[model samples]
Target: MTERRMVAAIDTSLVATAAAAFSVLCASTSFAGVLADSRWVFPALLVVVVVAALGVLGRRLHWPLYATASTQVAGVLVVLSSQFAEHAVLGLLPGPAAISELGELLSGAADVVRTGVPPVPAEPALQALVCLGLGLVAIVVDLVVVGLRSPAVSGLLLLCVFAIPASLSDTMLPWWTFVAGGVGFAVLLASGGQHRRWRRHEDREQVTRALFGPTSTAVAGTAGVIALLTGVVFTGVGTEGRLPGSVPEQFGGTDGIGLQPFTSLRGQLNRDKEVELFRVRGLKEPTYLRALTLRKFDPERGWELEGLTQGVEANAQLPLPEGTDIGEGDAQRVEIQPIGYRDPWLPVFGVPRFLSGMGVNWRYDPASGIVFTQTNQESRPYVQQLVVPKPTPEQLRDARGPMRVAPEYLDTTGIPPQVTDLAQRLTADAGTEFDKAVALNRYFTDPSNGFRYDLQTAPAGGGDALSEFLFRGKRGFCEQYASSMAALLRAVGIPSRVAIGFTAGYRQGDERVITTEDAHAWVEAYFPGWGWQTFDPTPLSDGRSALPQYLNSELHPAQQPSSAPDPAQPSTPPTDGSTPGGGPQDDQGARPAPVDPRETEQSNPWPIAIGVLVLALALLAAPAVVREVRRRQRVRAISGGAAGSAGLAWQEVLDEFRDRGAQPAATDTARQVATKLLEHHALDESGAKAMRALVVAVEREWYSANGRSDESLPETLRTVLDSLRRASPLDLRSRAFPRSVLQLLRPQP
Candidate 1:
């Protein structure tokens, strides 16, 4: 009868543990706001179910805790490996190659974590990560609840799962997640009582009735409601001063839409208004007015502007270019007047030799030829004396090769494999870097490649966006063309960067008027002797595109007429800007020009840091802290003369002995256990006397009818605890992480 009861008790605890773990896993579905869809949730759920099923099977087979845990972990690894990287493994089991492939997927997931915003794409890598993370959590939770019979200790593990989406999301998690967790915790607490009573040989009928009783259900329901309300109040109050806690719900919808420098440009081109931005004077032919240069490229965000690392405050005459040789038709004096335009970057015609009519607030980066100011230049028109390097076709073709430049310009780190392969194949026969660059430009501009200049394609996400644009969609405005060609140039070992500005608008009276519709993005490749030469890959039929004379000489016939858009035609002009309606704009529909993609939206790192810290503390400090708290509560109960005080003190002594590597058998009397501990550690007279006193008090409280509480039990218990601790290792590992506490935190099979 006793053996049967013990078996039954283990089965009851296993069921409770599995139920609690699954409930917490369901609450994790709040990640739907952070991921693109609910597909990831299914994989995470499978992980928890596998762990729970293995636990049941392990109990039936009478396997040790470690064997059960090991089997569950192996099962999870095999399932994920088969699902994600089956080719890498030799058979059903995971090998090093499979692990490496899974690691690469995790690296991809890290990239998405860094560069992507909320509703990030649910790629294979992220799905695998979700599976691995939740699966391990389920294993730890099962061990803590069933192996150690400490269901309350599992709360910390469940909180970590809840924290993932809560920390990453730009909005509040769905309320149902909290409710599910609260109800699960309540069930865990109720079932734990029943498990404990059944193990103590209580009547089976009474234990079952207590667990499933009407009063128990009502109490659990009330506790769950209280927990949910308390959690909401604390969570909302704690993060209120931080970012998303204060952000409105509507703002979160645009988070991971991959806003680029050209999305705004597309919106501007679509607007019906022909708002005049700038009026320019002084050029014999139309040329692009340079505003800002985007030197860094992100596979997801596209070309992004970066802060000026080295530059001087703008003055009358800026330093001249060092290695660039000025061609015959290089120098020109240009005057730019901003009318409706409002931007921080000043638009200049070419390589600036001298700049005037701007204050000290304007700074110029010499290497990039970008002029920026603290405030909008709408009221501050400037003049630039320029040396626009119009290298001839003969000169460009004879240039040695790509020159050594900043690593950022040559960075092709995250470019898609397909893009790199395509670039290599296209440039195979080319002799010089200039020829390779020209081939890439021609590839985009060639109508046979099926590239079209359309502004209607929806934005794409993930690192494969460039591949889609080049081989699949084949249609986008200047943003796609310039960004793709730049990526291609970098892949072929030619240092390349993107320039965002406006093309010289049509002639209006004596001055050329630049409108919001003329915003454009084009590629500039570094040539050995010629410096950075312009390459426009966008196939524009609207006449706003201005190809450099050198590119036209090399890529087109001498008498092609440049295919200018008719002056009378109401054609759409190309623009390179960021997301519209995302920020403040003027009446002309121009938002402040977007900064580098890195600077577009600065996220606060504190929430992520805090979440990480909390998880670490939970893992490293939770066991120690919980153990200390329970010890103090028992000590206080003895001091206050509470009923069952002597039994609580006796339990504390046994726990202390267990922590010090001593285990007393259940059949041993209190005196026998005390005598064995006294002899095993060779305790001094003081420790021996305290152990004898505790043994006496426990026996008196249990066997005597009076059931007297002993006032000296707390001090006696402390004396016995100190003696055991002193004989132990005397290190942080011994005190902070005692074996008794570790059994509750460590994962069992």
Candidate 2:
């Protein structure tokens, strides 16, 4: 009867300790991140599995504490593996083009994880590797406790059991993760006494030993290689978005409703490579592309707009520094273009002067050559001025020493050999890296290759996608062309990344309407001090890459004077060549039908107000939650059940023993009040055993502290009183407890 009671007490204490730990964990986890790119129902169902596992262990199936914990832990690992398969794991590529290709392929698999449906990314190679390596490692560690019977090993396993919650999801609420996490925590609580002793075990070792064999290793290696190589292909896809100066030419939008439900811009972004939405002509030196500054990175799969903390320096608003060498340049006009893309972000060259005729939120970053808009840049064109320097080719090349990479950029973008090989092949005869880089770009971008500007492509070949492009499918897009070039280059060892943008200005009249159709992707190579230089290797685009070309009614009259000139004439206005929208030709002067500021001001304020109000209401409801929580706790205590002061002490001891999160050390057990007399807090073997004795008493007799209720509390108190008779009280006892509970004090060692 005593042994049965002791076992029940241990189990109860574990449950109690887990509950407390679980509360802390839930408070810290973020469920939204997991549900963002994925469907909440998958993980919700997974959590349900854990709850069900717990329920079964308690009721019908009655699994041991270890069995319940192991099952839940396994489920969490599966969820995490599915999560990694979705987004982040592929983001480790070195370049944009590589990343895009891999991302698309994996995104297909992510579809399954999202819906909790079967048939995950079934590239047979990846599936065999899914559960063999790191997955096996986790199971082995868990088995070290279960099969090998080592408590120390078990504690380590339990500590690591939360890996999924920590690393996989963005901000998984520690609470939900604790559902599985509590099992390991429960196991840790029971890893003392003879129960914790190491013993020889077999079943788990059989699996571990099998996994270490050759077949599993090869499977793991293939998966890694594939992910790494494919990541290299799609690296540039993540950067696909609207640039400055692009106008709405069939661009996507909410059409005045809510977020994308069907045919939305949210997921359909990065469909094709054409980043350039604006253009800054006559800029001094080539600058970096600056998009929206990410305020906070949601670990799940998106970027949230944090407050605009980064802006012009406060000091800059004051008198300029003496040695700063800050100089104002001539005012240059920019012709903004709108692309058919869906994001609100607009790309631009040089610094943005201001959003002149815009009805959208926009920001400028001079450090990188970019302009960002709040809505799809393809729908509207905003005119602006820029301050820049126009440098000659020689000046740009010789102005500085050899190439240099920014210190901050080194860790993220290390050069690979494959890129270098392609660079060498492209620029074999060039004098310098810059000359070679530019020459290679020029060669590939030459007119003969038929690199026409077309969004559509003719499908070709078998399962081999890249093969179709390089050989059979000659006609291709920027993404195809860039990835092909980037892969061959990475094979050689060039520090290169895929670049996406516009070719040049598409002139309207005085200004340009850079269309979404003009979006393009190229290759960028780091040239030491020169930094990342853009290289467009697409053929037909190179023909019109420089300056604005006016599609005049009268083509160069010298080349062809009459409107009735031959079809093969170099430049002539044909009767069939009338401009599409009969609107008057436009240039950089005053724009027609300007943005009506009155309409912008007249926009209904209620929608934005309602959004703010909803957010406010959620925040206001917090206090009521706290009050309700306290009331329940109070009622439980007054019920004369297991949660009174005595029960509370018992609970505290169980928690104190677990020592999770941040806490002081566990110095004494209930029986050894005198021996420790502040002898260091560390417990020796004898002290440990003595503490274990007290644990048995509080656990079975006062099991409520361990998250279970006990009806025998009054009888347990009498039994505790009898035990106290045999113990001697110590000076420390007088100070730690209340004077009213003198009889409740335990005898010291």
Candidate 3:
């Protein structure tokens, strides 16, 4: 009966332990997820994790979980832990962000790492990775704690349960399961209680089997369904979503419809804006701008810019196939930087000689000349390339296309006609297309004429964006310049369009991998014979946007560094004649003399003496401290009389010696273990005076008592140790003659 009760107690303890561990896991996971979601909440997340760790330990001791419903809730808590992890977190942890949002984080990391891994970008994805790892360990412990309660198979089942989440985040599990399960089963064979448990656990076996019976059919069916759905979604979303998490929910609409933000997580996630991704293919990447369809602007039902869809039919405008959309022209590649496409209506570089990318399923509008994708903001990371036509300046100068004037163009295009008139006036004086391009380019670049380009960082004027740019603001970013220029050119009876893309950025040794900071926008004008001519109007005035360096860097994850973003910059032009991102301009002819080495050294005493002192202390003190610590540990390990030995007192003595600098290296074999003393380890010239007492005690023990001073062993040991230390390695080496005479004396004795 007692044996049966003990067995029952063990079984109960195991269940309780597993449940308790699960509770800790859930609580910790939920809090961690929260921190991972919002980096600022990390401290709170850490605290919860520590608390949960304590609970995990307590659970391993078999704390019961049948206490309340709160216990069950604890298991679920883990699902929500780790919130708002930064992109840099990925690099720091073995585990990655969940499959849902990791695409952008990791790919961004991969890109950052690619550009000379040495000066790495400081991204937050690495921290998120650590959280991922910790969460997994906690989950595993919870399972193993339970499994150990019964047979080893129980451990496997527990592992499978915990694995569900790990697999959800990092899906390389089938292999891990095979390896881990194999090793575990191998060990199960060695357990001695299995035979007895198998005979006695008939009831438990039945219960376990019933709860987790064969679901091969269900598993097979799930695989089939997943495969079919995956195929359909793939066909619908396009190649842009090759990486998981690449597709945002906003991009998954049908043939006529398109992708939009995932409304299901409205409160859980904030999809403030769609990320702008650019791709260049062919001649050069003409900037690809997302055409905003503006029909019903409700200020509340999201922006109504232009061409958005409402369904899913796996359809978007495919690129103009090899022989479509063009009559021969120079080979070229059009680059696109898709800003948030407010509506489905897409903007392009005049004639999109070819089109294929995310949201490319919309029907082309011949009247307005817009080709919108059938998807919304959350569908995918969009990047498309095309062989866009580039016309020569000579061709564009003599070309005039049929003009159509619609006052309603103001409403449909949502732009004022005055903006277009400006373009015409700007180009009126030019004789050739090239001349016009040169004139516009020169007007913007002239140093005397102070127009500048910068991404607006300050608070904006209330109301319409158009008014804000024309009257209230003197400086505009690349998009603003491109838009105004296009409007101006179009008004001059010229078929022109605004395009968005990255401008040429710093290119090293040849890989040509573009960075997020390179995101840019420009303009393209249609010409009669040659094709479309590209023109840049944004004055490269010196003012860098105060974006954190990483946000604009190709090196690290998008982590904001402390030095970035000049927050104190005022909006008005500086009296100093320098631009915002450019800093206070300096005279070009300044130079300075080189510094003297002696003066440089004089300024830094801490770096010289202090650094040396610290290093010396570490090297000289470590071995002694380690040895004493080891000796103390041994004292603690032994019992009774051995424990009462002078080991503890000697440890204290060693510590004092170290404090006074009598440190010995572990590799230093014992030699004149004595004179290391007189020259060093002693209390001044009292060294020999002090040495007399110790030598006499050792002599008596050695000669008269046969090396045994049982009653005074501790005192004798301490004295001999002190003398040995006095012998000093330096003194011993120099005093070899005395050592030879001492050897003769020993023989006589």
Candidate 4:
């Protein structure tokens, strides 16, 4: 009868501990904002109910451990069905529609993980995924901690749950959350050990004594101290400056769906490594290779590529440029041999009239005149028949105004006041829109204006970026020049947009090798009658001198006075002092400056030093702190009551003997432990008598129906504890930092 009752008590304790551990695991989901509002309440409550029910059912039915796992899996499916069933086929189970929705939700979550920097805002799809993941983690933790009875392994699993968000993004979790979870797992381990000890005994009195014994309390106390100290150390070593935070530009590529192209342009321009992107042949002159045009300009959000028209057949011809006549264009055939380049947008020198040797998966957008592939495709050698128009300045100057163009192409909604004023002031001397554009272009390209081209300057501010660039700092790269020029044209009522692509690469033998460093940005002004005309506002002196002769001729005389002698253009000087078209060249291209490592280290060393010192000190003092705390807890239990006082005293004596290397076996009774300690150590007569007396008190407390209480029992135990410490071989270590406390706290299998 007593054995059955003890087993029942052990089962009850395991069930309670499992429930608490599950609750703690669920609570950790709040750190990722999964429970920011009431939306998580239903799922969290369901998890609690399922975990509690499974624990109790498994204990009462004496079912195998596999039964618990099966029930938890069923609970997850039911919960998912109930939450998402409205979108399913039958409205009662997860059908095709529900599965598709789940796939889309997971895909969106993946995108967020790929692109977004946390703290990620809560969306329905992300919230659902987080809740599902949290539920699964909680079930695993419960199985590991309760079913397997390995709290240390469960703690490691819980640590993984906390590490996911921390590793994915740079956001730091709260210290209190770690402490709460750690405490819950520690309590589960302590309860598991106590349960196991109870199962070892058949007498109800022995089981009760084991439940509140010094070993159980010491385990609980030591685990609590270690967990709390760990939390403190983690908090002290804050996560700031430890993580590599996300930069949107670093991941940008050919799709134009992310901020990569816009944001990464600066780094690409500043990179010293020369990586060849592609190569071109059969070109009579160097011209900019147009890739994609950004038309949707929100002053606050910067430039954006709105849409792509996909799935046009390979044989389809591209539409003519908006306001140009194809009959008056010059045709040219160029062979493009791709080096290592792979972008969604194909590079072309002019408007493509015909394409050959390209894959069938390629598509074209007639409006933007860009050819793209649906999926990321490897770059291949292709031939293109392009219509390169040589429109005269007289024709462009006679083209119609903005009234004849599409309204979408002429939007100037968010231009700042300063930008408008500057545009008006710059074009004050010009009458026609073409002349006004020429004037603005002249303003940026003219060297006398003191506009120095630099790639390392700070980025322009949002909405007022043009204003800041033009009126304040005048140093920037091609992106600032192209974007600001586009905004200026829009402000003065000209339809224009920014185009990004590679410039004319250096000529090696007959092939032009285009590298990442040749990536450039320029504006295309829309001429109502003549179509979109390319305008290079970036200065010719800044590694970009290969402009079309027609545009170059128009700006040459207008920029320099006829009375003053023209200064030689500052070009990227080549090793031989000349390039194609008599342009200045650079030696092995312009190499960016090497990065300095000491700059980061020298910025703030004091804070790092202090943090390291504090962490080291805390770690060094942890063992002593835990030992002191366990000693205080044992003292309190001895002074509390007579029913458990003798048991507590006897356990303390055993811990001292165990710490000094005279460990008692699990089946050892109080008298056996006393005899072992006496034989191991050379104790005086008084010490031996005190040890025997403490053993007698413990045995009497265990067997007697009405426990005897004595006021002097606490005093007698203190005397016995001191005598054992003096007789032990490992005296100093036992008195200072007791290893037995750590042994009890170790998770029991």
Best of the candidates, lDDT = 1
Worst 10 residues of 3 by lDDT: 1-10
Q: Spell out the clash pairs found in candidate 1.
A: 65-749, 66-749, 68-749, 69-749, 261-577, 264-578, 265-577, 304-597, 305-596, 519-575
Measure candidate 4: CA RMSD. 15.7
* TM-score, cand. 4: 0.53
CA lDDT of every candidate: 0.67, 0.35, 0.36, 0.60
Superposed by TM-score, candidate 1 places the C-alpha of residue 710 at a distance from the truth, in angstroms, of 44
TM-score of each: 0.46, 0.31, 0.33, 0.53
- Candidate 1, lDDT over the whole model: 0.67
Any idea what lDDT model 4 has? Answer: 0.60
Pick by TM-score: which candidate is best?
A: 4
Clashes of 2: 86
TM-score of 2: 0.31
Where model 4 places Cα greater than 4 Å from the true spot, the runs are: 1-287, 306-316, 326-344, 373-382, 387-405, 431-435, 442-469, 472-479, 503-520, 528-530, 536-749
Error of 3 at 234 (Å): 16
lDDT of 4 by residue, 1-749 (tens): 11101011123344444545454554465354212234344454455456655665665476777887777766665556555434765554667767767676776565555444334334445556665776677677666666666656666766666555545533335545555555565555555544454432133344444445776566555655665565455434422212223222122223445433454454344332355677777765667888877876777657767544453554556666555553356688899988756555677877777777766677766556567765434658888888777777777778764454446567887888888898999999998888888899988866566554655334435436667778777767777788889989998989888887877776766666777667788888877666777887876443445565446666875543321112232123233212111111235534333222223323666634654575567656666665554455556656776346676566566666667766666555566767877888867777888877776776666676786865667777777777765766565556455676556422110
- Whole-structure CA lDDT of model 3: 0.36
Instruction: Provide the RMSD of all predictions against the true structure, rounded to 1 decimal.
Output: 19.5, 23.7, 18.7, 15.7
Assess the local accuracy of residue 241 in candidate 2 as a C-alpha lDDT between 0 and 100.
20
Tell me the tens digit of each residue's lDDT in model 2 across 563-606.
22122322211122111111111354221221222233237575
Model 3 over residues 417-484: C-alpha lDDT tens digits? 56555555677887765555555545543434444454431224664554355445645555455555
Q: In model 3, how large is the Cα lDDT of residue 657?
A: 44
